[model samples]
Structures are given as structure tokens and as C-alpha cells.
Target: MTIIAGVALLLAAVAFFLLPTAHLNTRSLVRVNGVARIVPPETKVAGLAELEGLQTGPGSMLDLTGDVTVLGAGAPAERTLSGRPLDPDGILPDGARIVVRHGDHVLEAIRRVTVQIPYETSVEGKGVIVSLVRPGVPGERELFKGVASGKQAAVFTTSAPQNAVIERTSSAASGLKLAALTFDDGPGKFTQGVLDALAAKHVPGTFFVLGSSAAGNKAMIEKIKAAGHEVENHSWDHPILTKLTTEQIMRQISRTEEVIGGSRYLRPPYGSYDAKVTAAAAALGHKLVLWTVDTRDWETPEVGAILANVKAQTKPGAIILMHDGGNNRSATVASIPVVIDWLFQQGYSLTTVAGLL
Candidate 1:
């Protein structure tokens, strides 16, 4: 073999041997019950803030932040850059920060917490109930896990409540007199404007809020209600429902409703759903209402694109799709006037989804 060829082979062998042994001492810790709890490396962690300036060396420190619980939500527990847990196995909140030390680097992390759901049915025909309680110190925040065991053979906990239902809704309007407008994925900053626009036009519409967004903005949610628009359930995380289990589907409905807790009618995210997805919703007394018109405002940021999409698609009894949240909605908001004006010119009367059917 040529000398260069032999050298290449030698380097390849050296890299293969060295790569497997290379690993930074990465830590995964969270606040539980107001203390920093070091989540084992084996635990799955998808929710953590970027630890840009944290110290992670032998002498690093970590400070607990917020409510100081191990399982609560929001802001990482603050930690000084030190290698030691100030009070090991202590409680910490959802957003608490922690520090670890490795040489001169102080490693840091924040709790990436998601709400735990109760009593979800799996797609495979099984039941799951997540106990808000997890084994931890006194006053430790409750922990949430994605995959929960069916029921503890040793003991079972109480069940969650059924989702709220729309008791008596107005008729789905006769002859499509007024064009009822509907917006999904909202409660965003622009939501107020959309509300204002509809109010100006004397139009009543429906808002399908994603569950997670609802939790983040309660004031806006109340405003949507106060604005006289119907608030309805969107999915929990706005993921494509078909990929999730029946229980997950219910969680999408229940969790969204978990926040809104009332107001029936749900428009699926991305117009995404299946028959099974519907059954999961029916179990919660939610009716699946697919939009007859999709403005597709989510596609381009251009207002013209939004207007064209809506103008091309909207028809009578159409549950036209637009959004007020989930990324910038300037385009969607811009298109509203175009669609409404056109519909009005076309002699379509505006009404709310509840009013429509």
C-alpha cells in the first residue's frame, strides 16, 4: 500500500477508538418542591432553557428560582455555578435553575416542565391515569411524566372531571344571512385587534384556542369571551391528531378545555383529524366541526396571499380558517377585511359558529 493510504487508514482507526469515549459530563436537573433534583441521565428531557453563561466546573454553583419546588412550573430554579446541590433532593418549581461544575465550565439548566394529564385513553384501547403526586420530599412539587402506568396495582387515585360542554347553543342560522367568522390558534397579541375588527363589523365569530396558549394568556382568553366571540377548544399542543393516541386526542381536547373549560366546538389543528380522533372528542362531548373554507393564512406572510386564499375558498356555511396565534398573524389579520368585505358583497351574512349550527 502507498504510504499516504496507510496513513489514512491509521487516522481512521484512531478516530473510531476516540469518538466513543468522548462525552461531556452533561447533567439533567429540575426543581421539585422548591429544591433542585438531579434528574438521572436516563430520564428523557426535552424542556430546558439554554444555559449560556452558567458555570459548569468542579467549583460551579446552582441557585433555585421561582416557587422553589421540584415539580412546579415556570422559570428555572436559580443556582450559583457550583458542583454541589445546595440541598440535595430538595424541592424546586418548574422553572428553577441548577448548576454543575466541570473544570472551569459551570453547567446550568432550567426545568422544562409540561402539565401532566389525567385519565387518557390510549389508541390501543387501554386507560391511563397520571397521579399528580410523585414520590418526593414534603412540599415537593408534583411531577409529570409522558408515559404513565395504567394504574398502580398497589393503589389507585381519584379520577379527573369531565370536560365542560356547551349546554344550549343557538341554531346554526338559517339561509346563511350573516357571515360568521372563525379564527383558530389565537389569543395572541393581535387577538384583540381581530376581536375589535369583528366588533366593528358587528360580526360574531368563534375562536379555537390551543390549550397551551390558553394557559399562557388568561387575560386575553377572558377578553375573547368578553368580546362576545365564542371560545372553543383547540388541541392541547396543536400537533397532528392522527399521529397521537385516543387518550392523547382527549388530552388535546380536555387540556384545551381544561383551561377554557367551557364553550363547545373544536376545529382541528392543520385541518388534521380522523374518525378515531372524532370518537375521542365525542367521549368528551365535543363535536368536530371541519372548516368548509381554508384561507391558508399560515402559508405565506404576505397579506395578498391570505386574501386570495380566503376569497377563493369562502362559501356560505363555511367555517373559514384563519389564525390569531401560533407564529406571526399579521397576514391572517390583514386578510380578514378582504374576506369579510367580499363575503358581505356576495350577500353572505356573518354569524358565529354556534349561531350557524
Candidate 2:
């Protein structure tokens, strides 16, 4: 009995010492996404969620533990982990390699933006008369784009652009020695006297008459035409064409054309024009006429100043501006004979606007 008890005590002492030594030598190694770590013996790791230093989300992971592989969670979406689908909560064994794969997914975001659309311009006409047909307007559009990876594409256009149209004349050639004497706001009290002055000089002139004036003085218009003068259109009320809308502009020009019958020219009041005005004139088959020499006769300047203006600015292909009837024109009528004689003495042959062109 004493020997048996002694043997049992020795066996207990050996077992205690051996157990501690074995426990100290044992170690657990785990590899996460190819990174290796040593863990305490008998350490329990419950799936990828329980793993330390792992970012867990709606994705996939691979568990290669002891010749067994498991692909866990999520498919091929944005930021998805690549592997066969498996249970993410399954326990992991020692010496296991856990591969977390972030697969591709479509990321979406919505934003509103304003984009500018530029207007285009086009030009027409080849005369010494330039006009703007249409002022171009810019356009706008909204787009919805889908981006995959790093590429972008246009979705659609919300508004289309409006283009501008311009009409212009080529530059006049030099040294032509041609001059056009033009009268505006005519068929008034002094119109006959002005015509008498031109007839005395045997010169041809262009008369831009108001529709209202021409309507009242139809006989005078025919008489002026008989005197070999060119009668053309001046606006009915003579408002600034640029300030008027397209419809108003058309009315102003068309009414004058209707009254004047066969006139082919339009001299906008105050020498002002815009795209709408020019387009309206062109649509009525009228060419715009502007002056090179402004006598400022409407201001009733001195006859000498008016003559000086004519002489100073007259050139080849010159269009001289004079007013016969807008206001009291005793000065204009008086200056007419003197101006015509001076031009003749300067070796200039006065002609109509059409003749000058």
C-alpha cells in the first residue's frame, strides 16, 4: 500500500510539469489576406467578423483553413470580396488563411448643374449695305450621366441653341468719284422748292419719304417721280428700329413700302438698326442705305456749315444726307442751290442713291 501511493504521487508530479511545458511550446498561426499572425493556443476565431484588424461589410471573404476553402457573402458588386459564397460566421481554425476580397460595385450620386450653350453666327449679303437679320440667342440643357469606373458620357440636351444671322456689304472700292444726294422726311412744304433746286442743277436725288407724308401727298409723290427722283421708304412714325420688336419693325417698314408702291430702299431713322430691322427690310426686298456725309441740316445749321459738311466729307461712292422736310428747312432749301453749284464746281456729278451704287 505505501509503494502504490508513492508511485501515484510521482505520476502526478510528472504530469503537471509535462503539461505546462507542452502548453508553453504550442502556438497558433493565422494568415489574414496573406498577412501572418501568431495567436494564443486554443484561441477561438469566429469568422471574418470576429477577426481583428479586418474591415467587415457587405462583401465577400475567403477562408482557406486546413485544406478547406469557403467564399463568404456578397457577389460581384462594387467593393465586393471575390470568393465562393460561404458562411461568414463560421469559426476559423489555426493556421487558416482568410482572404477578404472587395468586389466592384456601381456607385451612384445625383447632382444638378447648369451648362452654357453658345450661339452660332452666320453672315449674308455682299453690298455696301450691312444689316443684322437675327440676333442669336444662347441655349441651355440638362443632362443625366452614368459613370462606370472612370468614364463619362452625355445623356441628353434639354434646350437647343439659337444661331445669329448677320447681313453685311463688302467695302466700296476707292476713287470712284461717285456721290448720292439723299433727302429724308420729305414731300413737305419745302419739298417742291428742294426739287426745284435739284431741277435747276439737272441733278438726280433720292427722297426717303415718310409713309404718312406720302399718303397725304400722293400727287406730289408722282410729281417727284416725274421729276426723275428716286422715292424710297422712311418709317411711318420714324421710331428707332432697334428698340422695336420684330413685328413692329415689319409693320413700320411694310406700311411705308405699301404707300411708296415701288420703292426699293430703306433708310432707318437716326441711322439706327439691329438684326430685326435689317431682316425686316431684306424680307421686303429693300436694301438698307446709309449716308457718308451728314449735313446736320435737321439742326438747321448755317448754310455755310451745311456746305462745308458736304465739301469736307464727300468722297468716292459718297452718300450725302440732307433733310428737306423734318423741320423748318429754309436753311436746307437755301443751302441746296449753293451746295449743288459748289459740288458741280468741284467736278462732282450728283446722282441718285441707285446711280451712286
The best candidate in terms of lDDT: 2
Q: Residue-wise lDDT of candidate 1 within 1-357, one digit each (tens)?
A: 699999999999998777843133244466533456654343322222233333222332222221222222333344432334445334333345555324432223433333333323222221110111211111212332222221112222233323322222223553455446778887788798788778777778789888898899988888878877899987877899978987888888888887886756777776665555666776787776666566777778787877777678665566677888877887776767777788888888777777777
lDDT of 2: 0.73
Clashes of each: 67, 14
TM-score of 1: 0.50
Q: What C-alpha lDDT values do all the predictions have?
A: 0.61, 0.73
For candidate 1, the clash count comes to: 67
Candidate 1's C-alpha runs over 4 A off are 1-178
Cα displacement (Å) at residue 221, model 1: 1.0
Per-candidate TM-score against the hidden true structure: 0.50, 0.59
Q: Tell me the deviation in Å of residue 168 in model 1.
A: 22
Report the error of model 2 at residue 316, Å. 1.0
TM-score of 2: 0.59
